[model samples]
Target: MPKMKTKSGAKKRFKVTASGKIKSGQAGKRHGMIKRSNKFLRNARGTTVLSAADATIVKKYMPYAR
Candidate 1:
């Protein structure tokens, strides 16, 4: 049987941690920084774990991640 292919876009954007959580960069920071508040920028500075609903989708894209 053919091997399952991982989604290239998901591979670059999401990371599966050792404990099986998905780590991804903050969203909404690509443009319009001036319109955003300081607090939003501060809180979105680093990676955040995906919620259960989102992680399930990512898991399908990255079958070998776990």
Candidate 2:
């Protein structure tokens, strides 16, 4: 079989943590900050682990990320 081609966009957007969790930047911070509360901004400042269901999808795009 041929080697699988990793998704270029996924490789740049998602990261495989040391523990194997998929980490990506928090959502809802791209715009509309005026409507977003200070607490939300603070809490969503860094990357977050993708939910198990969501991680499964990302994993497909990054076969070798495991």
Candidate 3:
């Protein structure tokens, strides 16, 4: 069987933690910060865990995660 390949885009976007959880960046952090409150921007700085169902799909693109 052929080796599974990682998706470059997915690799850059998602991260798999040591405990098997998927961590991702929050949205609305790139631009338009002038209108957004400091509190909102602060909250977006942390990583979020991907849900089980969504993680299953992402795992395919990130073969090494498993």
Local distance difference test values of all predictions, in order: 0.95, 0.95, 0.90
Local accuracy of candidate 2 as per-residue lDDT tens digits, 1-66: 998999999999999999999999999998899999999999999889999999999999999989
TM-score of candidate 2 against the unseen true structure: 0.92
* Poorest lDDT segment (10 consecutive residues) of candidate 2: 24-33
List model 3 lDDT by residue over 1-66, tens digit each.
998889999999999999888889898888899999999998889888989998889998997778
Q: Lowest summed lDDT over 10 consecutive residues: which window, candidate 1?
A: 57-66
Question: What's the CA RMSD for each of the models?
Answer: 0.7, 0.9, 1.5
For 1-66, candidate 1 gives per-residue lDDT tens digits of: 999999999999999989999999999899999999999999999999999999999999998887
What TM-score does each of the candidates earn?
Answer: 0.95, 0.92, 0.80
Of the candidates numbered 2 and 3, which has the greater TM-score value?
2
Evaluate residue 64 in candidate 1 and report its C-alpha lDDT on the 0 to 100 scale: 89
Backbone collision tally, model 3: 0
- Where does model 1 exceed 4 Å of error? none
Model 1 misses residue 56 by how many Å?
0.2
